[model samples]
Target: GRNEKISAEARDAILARGEELGQALAERLPEVEQLLAMPGADQIEVGKKLRGQAQPLIDEHYRTVLRLKPRLAPIKAAVFPLKRNHDQLVATAKEVRRRLQLGSEMRTVYDDTGAIGKLYRRQDEIGTPFCITVDFDTIGQGKDPALAGTVTVRDRDTMAQERVPIAELESYLRDKLRG
Candidate 1:
């Protein structure tokens, strides 16, 4: 059976707990402390280690998707308008993508070639870490006025989503990539 999907906050908490445990162990063992202070695995080694990590998600023997984490994913984020017919949404998506790319190392793309599902599947297959969807709420046209300036961020692995303010998107994604 598939594992229960966890939210970003939950994952962060779990990581923090693990770090605490590792630190406690390090304090009791000198060797562990030295290892903890040492640098991490090199990019090539990490790449080689993660080479076989990419997985395909299958659903009902019909749909399949490639999975990757930020470390392995070339494209970090994907921006898309809720509907191609909506001029404002399309413009917002483009603007969001532009903002995400300016002076940043993040690789972002604006996609509207087909339905949202198909677009998501393409991103998943290509190992995109996250997807940002600009919808009516983001443009202040939806029922919720408070959701303006926020986009829906979807995690490709867990398929979990959260509403994130556009202003903090870059930092948010950067932190995720680091971890």
Candidate 2:
């Protein structure tokens, strides 16, 4: 193989780009260190940055948390069935919640009363980050065969839903809450 040397201009440009990156990192290093230390003031700032959810809740018990991240919420996740009256759905929901509690050791709730919308609102009011629903698809009743043995995870802030395999539910939630 033949060796080629860079032009002086190209070399200088590379050096300048390296310097810029180094300076940017140096300026941000202290901020990163402070966040790692997480003092009261820094924690407050972080809380503010993490609280992206809108709307207001009248419950004073969680009003302070309404300004913080879902990870900071007392109840990290809630499990429910799409239809509370369905016995199989309710049982699966309870087992799923219990498994999450044992697997992650996080605060998890099971709700079988009222509509799914109402259940979500109640969990959101308490600052819960995730709501996992055991729907008909999860129990192999849906047309999609691949959906069996999976649950729907709903994000509290965005209300976005995603299919997650029941076997991986604990780890999936653990990674999400870590942020």
Collision count for each candidate, in order:
0, 0
Tens-digit lDDT string for candidate 1 (1-179): 11135444544444454345455542334433332333331122322222222112112123455666686788899999999999999999999999998949888999999988788888888889899999999999999999999999998887899999999988898988998
lDDT by residue (1-179, candidate 2, tens digit) is 11135344544444344344345543444433333343232223222332221112212223332434867788889999999888899899999999989887699999878888778778877788999999999999998989999999998877799999999999999899888
* Lowest lDDT 10-residue stretch of candidate 2: 52-61
Poorest stretch of ten by lDDT in candidate 1: 51-60
Task: Give the runs in model 2 whose Cα sits over 4 Å from its true position.
Answer: 1-67
Best by TM-score: 1
TM agreement with the true structure for every prediction: 0.65, 0.62
What is the Å distance of residue 10 in model 1 from its true position? 53
